[model samples]
Target: MTRLFNEPSQFADELVKGFVAANSQWVRPVAGGVVRRAPTVEGQTAVVVGGGSGHYPAFGGIVGPGLAHGAAMGNLFASPSAQQVHSVAVAAENRGGVLLTFGNYAGDVLNFATAEARLNSEGIVTRTVVVTDDISSAPVGQEHKRRGIAGDLTVFKAAAAAAEAGYSLDEVVRVATEANDRTRSIGVAFSGCTLPGQTEPLFTVPAGRMAVGMGIHGEPGIAETDVPTANELAELLVSSLLAELPPSIATAQDARAAVILNGLGSVKYEELFVVYGRVAELLEAAGITVVEPEVGELVTSFDMAGVSLTLFWLNDELEGFWRAGADTPAYKKGRVGSPSSASTAASTADTQSFAEADRLTLAAETAASLPTELPDSSDASRDAALAIADAIEAIAEVIDEHADELGRIDAVAGDGDHGIGMQRGSRAAATAARSAALNGAGALSALSLAGDAWADRAGGTSGALWGLALQSVGAALGNTTEVTGSAVATGVSDAVSGIQSFGKAVVGDKTMVDAMVPFTERLSREVNAGGDLVTSWRAAAEVATAAAAGTADLLPRMGRARPHAEKSLGTPDAGAHSFALIVVRVGEVLASRHSEFA
Candidate 1:
C-alpha cells in the first residue's frame, strides 16, 4: 500500500486516543469518536472550532488557554458529524457560552450549524464564526465564498482573546468575524498527498509543475504551470493578498498586518523560510508593515507538499487582546508592536529594462577565425558517437507526448511529473542540439550546448543527474572529427560512470543507473568484439530495456519518496524507461547511416 498507516478506519481512533492521553491537562475526549474537548478559563466564553483531521495543531492542537477552547475533529481530510461537534461543545461550554468557528466547507457548515441548533435548544447560547480567507475561492465582491485556510489561526486567536477578556458570545463572534473579513490566504502545491491506507492519492500534481490555488484538502485548483522559484512564489502570493484585502483594512491603523507563513508538512523549515524571506520583501515593497511574523506548522495536510500565506488586518482592540498573556502547551502569546509614530519616506526606482539597446556586437573577423569543424577526421569512432547523440535529439518529440502518462506513473509511487520533467529536458536538449547542428558546429560543440540546455530546462535531483550524463558524453567526444564503435563505447561508459557518481545510485536501486549499466555493458562488449556501431547500439538498447524491466523486482532505495516508496515489483522506473527509449531510437538512426562510418 502507498499509505504508511496500518488500518485506515482505525487511524482516527488511535490518533485521537493518543492525543487525549498525551494532553489530558487541557483536553478530554467527547463521548463520540472524533472531537477533543478542551476546558476554557472561568469568566471567559468558550471558543469552539472544528474541521477535518490531518491538518492538525489547526482545529485541535490550538485548543488551549489563549486559542480554541474545544475542537471537533474528524477522519483524515473528512468533516466531523453534527453529533461530534455538539458533544465537544458540551464539555467545552462554561457560564459564558460557546463561540463556534470552523473552516468554510459544505460538510463543516452543515455539521457545525446542526450542532449550534442542538446547543441552542438546550438553553446554551452559541454564536458562529466562519472563516473564508482563500482568495481563489471567490472574487473581491464575493469574498464570503472563499475557503478558510491558514487564516483560521488569526481568527481563532482574535476570538479566543475576546472570550478570555469576558466578551459575550455575540461580541466574541464579532471580533473573529472582523479578523476573518480582513484576512486573505493563498497556497501552492509542489505535489499532492494521500490519505491513510489508500493505494492511490486523491489527485496528482505534475512534477516541476505547480498548481497555484491548491485547496487545503484534495480539492482541485485554478491553474497549473511550471514551478516558480521561491521568490516568484512569494511575489505571486503577496501581490494577490494585497489586491484582495479590503482598502479600509489596508489603510486602517497604519496598514499594519500579521503575516503567517504556514507549512503544510513535508516542506522543510529551511524552504519555508526561503519563501518567507521573499514574502517579507514583497510585503515591504507594497507598503504593508508586518507585525510579529509567524512561521511554523500552524496548519498541515499530513505529508502534503505545499505552503500557504495568511494576512490578518490588525486593529487597536484586537491588538490589545492579542498582546495579553496566555498559557497553553502548544501556543504562546504574541506581543503587539507600538504603532509607528513617524512617517517613513519611500523610494521609487524605475525597474523597466531596455533590451533592444543592449545587443552584443561580435565582429565578422572573429567569427571567421573560429573553426567550422574539428581539426582531425581520422577516427571513425568519433562519427559513431555523434550519430548516437543526433538520434537521441531526433526522438525527443515522442517523449514529450508521453509527459502526462509519466506524471500519472510518478503519482502512483512518487511525486508525479518525472515524465513531464524528462520530456521538457529532452525537448530542450534536442532544440539546443539541432540549433548548433544547423549552425554547422562540430559534434562535441552541438552535444555540449544540448547538455547545458537540458540542465537549464529541467531542475531537480534527477534532471541534474541526466544532464551530467550528457555533459560527460559531450566532453568525452570533444574535438573528435570522426566517430567509431570503440569511441562510442568509451563515451557511453564514461557518461554512465559520471551519472552514477553524481546520483550515487547502484544497480537495483530502482533508478536510471539500472538501465544505463546494461546499455554500457552491451556497448563495451560489442566494441571489444569489433562489431559495427549499429549492431552494438541495438544490442545495448535491448540490454537497457531488459534492465529497466528488471527494476520492477527491486525496492526503491533512493530519492525523496523513500518512506512510502513501496515495492515497485511490476513497473519500470520512469527514468530507466526514458533511458531505454533513447538507446533504442539512437541505435535505429545509426543503422541507417552505416555508409558514413565505413
Candidate 2:
C-alpha cells in the first residue's frame, strides 16, 4: 500500500511537479502536462502521447528529443480532459499539425477525439492514432478494441521518430497506426496494486497463483493459475504473443521482431532479465530473429507485481525507426542530435511567454464557441438558479460520503477511479454553479458553467458525459421566467439524448444510461400527465434508483467494465449508482426547500 502522500487528490499534480524539477533537461511543465524543455522546432509535427499517470516512462517520462513532444498527463488511471489535451497540443507548437496518440481506452478515446476536433477546428490539423496492441483485451478480428500496454513504447517511438525526422502530420499518424497494427502484447500479474491512501488493493490474486491477461490499470486478470518458474512464465508470455503475430508475418522463420519484455512495476530488472533469457531462447528455437530487445521496465502499473511481453513484427522501415536514438528522462537509446537551445534564463522566459500566448489564444477561441455574456433573467429564473446551485452542492456532499463504496464497486471490473472522479467533478460543478448563481446568473448559465468545470476538473469518460448532460439540460431550460414541469421534462429528455449522441452508450450497457433512460422516461410520463416538477422528479428518481440496482444482474457492455464482465455481474455499475443517488437527492431538494422552482 502507498505510504507517502500529501493528499490522495493532489497526487497526480504533485508528482508531476517533482518529475519536472528533476528532469528539467528533458521536460518542462505545461498547464495540463509537459512538453520538451529544449528549443522549439519550427514546422516539426509534434508527437503528443499520454494516458493515466502511474505508467512512468510511458507518458511524461519520454518527453524529449526524438520522442513525444508533449504528453497530456491524467490522474491515476484516468484519461485527461479534452481541454488538457488541447492545452498541451497548443503549447507543443502545432505548425505542422499535431498527432495525438495514446492507449485505446474509452475515456482516452473520447477525450482525445474531442481535443482533435477542437484542434482541427482551430486550423491546427490534429489527428489521432490510438494504440491498440494488447492482445488480451480483445480477440482476433476485434483488434480495434484491444488496449495498449507495454507496446505503447513501440508505437510512440515510431511516431515520434517519424515526427523528429520531419514527417508530415499525416505521415506521422500513418507510422503510428502501422506500429500499433504490428505490435502485440500480453501480461500476467502475481499481485494487484494499491492506489495512494487506499487500504486494500484493487484486486487480489490467490496465493501461489498468477493472474493471466491482466491489464495495467488495476483491472483483474482474465484467468488465474498456479505460479510457474521464471522460464515457464517466459514461455507462456512468448508463446502467447507468438501465436498472435501480425498478418505481415506468415511464419516465425520468415520474420524478425523487436521484443519488449516489460516489468509492470515491482518486478526487478534481474527478474525480468531471467524471464527474457528464456523468452529469447524460445524465440530462437522457433526460428525467429529478435532485434534490439528491451528487458526492463517500460510501462509500469504503480506497484503491480506483473510483467508483459511485446512483439513488434518489424519491416524495413519499422526496423530503421526502431533503431533510431531517443533521449528522454527515463529511456535513452543510441546517440541523438540535439535541437538548438537558448540559455537557461532566456529559454524559460521565452517558453513561459509562448505557453501563456497559446493558452490565451485557446481561451479566446473557446470563448467564441460559448456565450460571452450571461442572459438577462427574470427574478423567478434567478431564484431557480439558487435551487440548481444548492442541488449540485448537495450532490457533492453525497458523492463524497459514498466515494469509498463507489470505488470498491468500480474496482470489481474497472479501474476503481469512478468515486474519486465523481467526487472531484461534483465538487467542481457545485462550486461553479454556486458562484454563477451568486452572481445572479440564470439556470442556463449556472449549469453550463458547472458542466465545463465538472469536465475540466474530473477529466474522464464519466466527467465528459456528465458535463455534456448538464450542458444539454441547460440549453433546454434556457432563461425562462418560470421553471415548469414541462421545461424540466424537456431538459431531461435533451440531456439523455445528448449523452447518447456524444458517448454512444445505450440502455442495458450497464452504464449511467441504464438508469438515465428509465428516469427520463418516467419523468416525461409524469410531466406529460400534468404533474408538478417536484413530484415527477421524485417518481423518476425512484425509477432510476431501481434501474441502477437492476444493473447488478446485467453484464457490462461498455467502458472498462466490459473486460471483466463476469466479475462485475454481482455489482451495479458505479456510474449508474452515482447518477441514481444524485438525482434522488436533487428530488428531495426540489420537493422541500425549492418548491417554488419546482
Candidate 3:
C-alpha cells in the first residue's frame, strides 16, 4: 500500500512537482506536464509522449534529449485531458509539426485524437502513432485492439530518435508505426498494486501463485499458476512472445531483436538481472542476437510486484535509431552531445507567448461551438436549473454511497478506480451545476458547466463518456424555455447517441451502454405515448437498473476488463451499475420536482 501522500486526489500533481524540482537539469515544469530543458532543434518534429501518472520513468523521466520532447502527465491510471495534451504539445513544438505517441488505451485514444485535431486546426500539423504491443490484450487478427504496455519504450524511443535526427513528421510517424507493429510484450504479477491512501490493492493473487498477462495498471491477469522460478518465468515470457512473431520476423533463429526486461515497480534490479540472465541464454540458444538489452524499470504500476519483457524486432534503420544516444533524467545511453545554439533561453519567451496564443485560440473555438444565443432569465428557466442542480446533487450522494461496492466490482478485472472516478466526477458536476444555477444560468447552461467539470475532474474513460452524455443532453435542451417531456426525451436520446458515438460501445459490450441504450429506448417510447417526465423517467430508470444487473451474465468486450474477460463474468460492470444508480436517483429527484418546472 502507498503510505506517503498528502491527499490521494492531489498525489499526481505533487509527484510531478517534486519530479521537476529534482530533475531541473533535464526537465522543466509546464502547464500540463514536463518538457525538456534542452533547446529544441529548429525544424525538427517534436515527439510528445504521455499517459497516466504512476508509470514514472515512462512519461516524465523520459523527457529530455533524444527522447520525448514533452509529456502530458495525467492523474494516476487516467489519460490526460485533450486540453492537457494540447498545452504540452504547443509548448514543445518548434514550427516543425509534432508527433504524438502513447499507449493504445481508450481514454488516451480519445484525448490524443482530440488534441491532434485541435493542433491541426491551429496550423500546427500533428500525427499520432498509438503503441499496441501487448500481445495478451487481443488476438493477432484484432491486433489494433491490443493495449500498449512496457513495449511503449520501443515505439517512443524510435519516434523520439527519428525526430531528434531531423526526420520529417511523416517519416517519424512511419518509423514509430513500424516499431509498434514489430514490438511484443508479456508480463506477470505476484500481487496487485495499491493506489495512494487505499488500504487494498486492486486485485490479489493466491499465495504461491502468479498471475500471467497482467496489465500494468493493477488489472488482474488473464490466468494464474503456481509461482515459477526465475528461469521458468523468463522462459515463459520469451516463449509467449516468440510464439507470435511479427510478419517481418520469420523465425527466431534468423531474428535480431532489441529486448527490455522491465520491472513493474517493486521488483528489485537484482531480480530483473536474474531473469534477464535466463532470458539472454534462451535468445542466444534460439540463434537470435540480442542488441543492447535494457534490464530495469521503464514503465511501472504503483509498486506492483511484476515484470514484463518487450522484444522489438530490428531492421537496419530501427537498429540505428535504437542505438542512438539519449540523456534523460532516469534513462541514459552512450554519450550525447550538447544542445544546439538554437535552443537558447532567448527563445523561451517566444515559445511561452506562442503557447498562450494557442490556448486562447482553443478556448475561442470551444466557445464558438456552444450555443451563441443566450436566453433571457425567467422564473421557469430558473426553476428548471434548480431542479437540474438538485438531480445532480442526488446523483452525487447516491454514487458516494455505492463507491466502495463499485470499486470492489471493478477490481475483479480492472484497476478498481472506476468508483473513485465516478464519485469525483459526480461531486464536481454537482458543484458546478449548483454554482451555475446560483449565478442565474438556465438548465442548459448549468448542465453544460457540470459536464465540463465532470470531464476535467474525473480523468478517465467513464468521465469522458459521462461528460459527452451530459453535454449532448444540454445541447438538446436549449436554454430558451422550460424542459418538457418531449424535450427531455429528445435530450436523453441525444445523450445515448453521443455516448455510443464517442465510446463505440454497444449494448452487449458490458459497458454503460448496456443500461443506457435500453433506458433511452424506453424513455423515448413512453414520452411519445404522451407520458409526463415523471412517469417516463421512472419507467426508464427501472429498465436501466434491470439492464445493468443483466450485465453480470455478459462478457466484457472493451476497456481494461476485456483482457481478463472471464474474471468479469458474473460481476456487474462498475460503469453500468454506476450509470443505473445515478439515473434511478435522478428519476426520484425529477419525480419530486416535476410540478415546479411544469
Q: What is candidate 1's lDDT per residue for 1-598, written digit by digit as tens?
A: 2355655445665787677656544454553332222334565788888776778777767766666777887545545656567767776787788888988875567557767998999988887889998887667788766778999988888898888778888899889988888788988887667666444564568879988777776455677889988898888888777776665563533477888999887787999899999998887877777888889888888778888898888878876655665444456665422111110121222101111111111133224323465433234434544554567566576576665555555544554546645665677778767766555555576667676556534434455566667777766666455655776688789988887766678897888899999899988998799888788889889999999878777777765233224535566677787787777777777788776553
lDDT of 2 by residue, 235-319 (tens): 8988888888788778888688899999988899999988888999999999988999998889998888999999999998888
Candidate 2 achieves a global lDDT of 0.87
Q: Which of the two, 1 or 3, has more lDDT?
A: 3
The candidate scoring highest on TM-score is: 2
Q: Identify the runs in model 3 with alpha carbons over 4 angstroms from their true place.
A: 218-223, 251-255, 337-379
Question: In candidate 1, which residue ranges exceed 4 Å CA deviation?
Answer: 1-3, 32-43, 250-253, 334-598
**Per-model CA lDDT versus the true structure:** 0.69, 0.87, 0.86
**lDDT of model 2 at residue 377?**
82
Candidate 3 residue 159 C-alpha distance from true site, Å: 0.3
Residue range 1-598, candidate 3, lDDT tens digits: 7889985667787999788767666776776687887778789999999998889897999998888999999877888877678878988999999999999988999988988999999999999999999887788899998889989999999998999888999999999999999999999999889987677888888889998988887565568899999999999999999999999888889779999999998899999999999999999999999999999999999889999999999999999989999988888987776532333343656556544654575466456434555456667777788889999999899988887788888888787777777877889899989988887788788889889778766777888888878888877776777688888889889998888888889989999999999999999999999888899999999999999999999999888888678878899998999989999999889878988544
Candidate number with greatest lDDT: 2
Report the Cα lDDT for residue 311, model 1: 87
Instruction: Compute each candidate's TM-score over C-alphas.
Output: 0.55, 0.93, 0.88
RMSD versus native structure for model 2: 2.9
Candidate 1 to truth, TM: 0.55
